[model samples]
Target chain A: MRYFTTTVDLKDSELDHSIYVQCLQLRREVFISQMGWNLYQHMGCEFDQYDTPASVHVVALQNNAVLGCMRLLRTDNDLGNATYMILDAHLGRIPNLPSGIMDEQIQSQDTWEASRLAISSRVPTSERNAVLVDLLRTGMEYVATRGGTSLLGMMNPVFLRVFRRAGLRAYKFGRIADQRDGRLCVMKLDLEPGAAMVAA
Target chain B: MKHPIQEKFNKYGFVILAPGQVPSDAITTFSDEWKEVYFRNEFHKIDPVFEFAVRSTRNSNCTLLSEAQMTNELFEEARMFEADSNFVSVSHYGGNTMVFGGVNPELDPRATASIQHACQATHRIELLKNLDLLTDTQIDLMEMAEEGFLDKEIASEFGISLSAIAQRKQAICKAVGTDCFKSTLRLYTLQKWGGLVGEYT
Candidate 1:
């Protein structure tokens, strides 16, 4: 099987074309057309404004055809902050979990932040999940490189479980509420290096 | 003589050549070369598909089976793959059995109902027809529709200020005559596009 990967810096206008359009279409087809998520109203085609300049896009290809894609946004900016605030109110309060000596290493770091993530269903589950893991790891690494101590986000519980199982210190923040789809969890993960950050 | 299969394998990650297409001598040569490269392993499967357990690792725990089995497994798993005409078909497990190929649309009933309720509550369709009155550029700006992209992303994608996207969206709401942007537009669009004849007619 032939495989290829490309990172699309949303900052680059060269990649803003039909390929991105197709990716948006797939997102709509899965998240809207089929699933009936009313989150986005259809334009002439599937798209929305969040595909802006700061978003980092990654696409996977097989035999020259796009198989899957994802977008990552750095949350350093005011509006680009993580989903924690929206979810924090609903989730109530963050729980205190047991931490190891590694927690000290993380707490010593100065800054902590998070990001927003969106993924397409076009890629196979295995490949897509692997890509997600890679993206998360990359994001965490990027934060570490910047001397940040932690990463946080409002993630679906299922994904939170994946993060926890991978040895990341994923915690639920705020109060839990029954969403239309079920309970939504405000998840946080500390990214400082140490045994505690290692997957169990 | 070297087999053509070996030569193809060297060039392509995998191949599915039709039977009797290559000369016997070339096949032998290719097969020998393939064994050398692949350590005597035959290309038993070419991009075989597999349905995995929900919690399985992305790299492991998938069962390789025939296409039919894969489809059946996916059905059993309640997962869907998008089906496209141009997709190549292959199975994972050993055997020659074949089944439907391509990705099937996975629908979440709850999500659908949520969308329907939101659409009905808001009237989405009526808003779209009025979209023409907006500038061509404004119309082009509407494509980044996913909720995840947020306001800032919308602004950058359209090369407009965030305030501009918000204002245009507000204009869209006023044009469609609804207060809620998402729900109203969806319901309006659905009702407008439902019948055999166009809603405008």
Candidate 2:
């Protein structure tokens, strides 16, 4: 598996556009079609207000096809009327997430939020775990090398087991909220340079 | 593989919690509306089921919500929303608490035992909340312990005295709310694996 980062800007690169499209479609298939989440979609691609140029898209590819993807936004980022998604949710700006989900408000260059992680359902069951490990390792390295100390995000509680199996250490913090998608809890992962992968 | 506890208790509904003031991070199979009202109204503040679980010295609390309890203000308010009644509320409090409420009049003995095990597992992850308090050496000790290293082996590997190893292990246990090396290692593994990650398809 190969992983890379790109943005949604087609004009930025003629080469990245194809990969970005695959990433968006992967999200569309997972979030909207499979999980039945109500999201912004156009022409078989899923995106929302958070998908700005400042956002980094991490895509997992194998055999030249997108297998998984996630989006990363620095916690300190400010894009006009919005910050990051989790912070916005905690401030009551996002209606779907409860206001008190996070233990404390965070805005720091050393921290980033990883969101919209989706692996292709079509991947063979035996290979899904490898895809997840690669996707997370790639995302972690992307942030760790860029001076991030931690990664914070919301996830369904059951998904925690998969992370455990992958040998990634995640700590659950704050309250678990009943969101429209499912039950979710705030989690933090401390990062170390070149330490993204540990023997599973 | 499905969790054995989950499979055994598939017929029941419950909320499992770590050591926290509220059940905000509870693992529950309760209905959405039930949670909506329970959390929106901040009823956990007055929830007798939760109160019993939090205050009881015993490891387990098993009782049907009495007619008197059902008539109480909390349940009265809950009833207006068409919540289920004749409820049996069973909770097991370890480092974490598994509070199971169901309409069933009779609960299987095995189900309650499963709830207890779930609480234990839930608490194992909750122990990680204290990770920041542990020093680098203490953290390394924990990792080594999780890798199945014995106390003597770890002491030898770190070139520390056996007494020094014991001191650090005790500190680690106190920080994470475990009593011994075995449980502490369990907590470490749970923290390592019971975390959120990019979802697998």
Top model number, lDDT: 2
- Residue range B20-42, candidate 2, lDDT tens digits: 43565344455567677777877
Going through the candidates in order, their DockQ values are: 0.02, 0.06
lDDT of 1 by residue, B56-82 (tens): 212122122344644443234223222
lDDT of 2 at A57: 72
True contacts kept of each: 0.00, 0.10
lDDT at residue B108 of model 2 (Cα atoms): 53
> Chain A alone, TM-score for each of the models?
0.60, 0.85
Per-candidate TM vs. native?
Answer: 0.36, 0.48
Q: lDDT of all predictions, in order shown? A: 0.40, 0.63
Candidate 2 global TM-score:
0.48
Please state the error at residue A198 of candidate 1 in Å: 16
Model 1's alpha-carbon lDDT is: 0.40
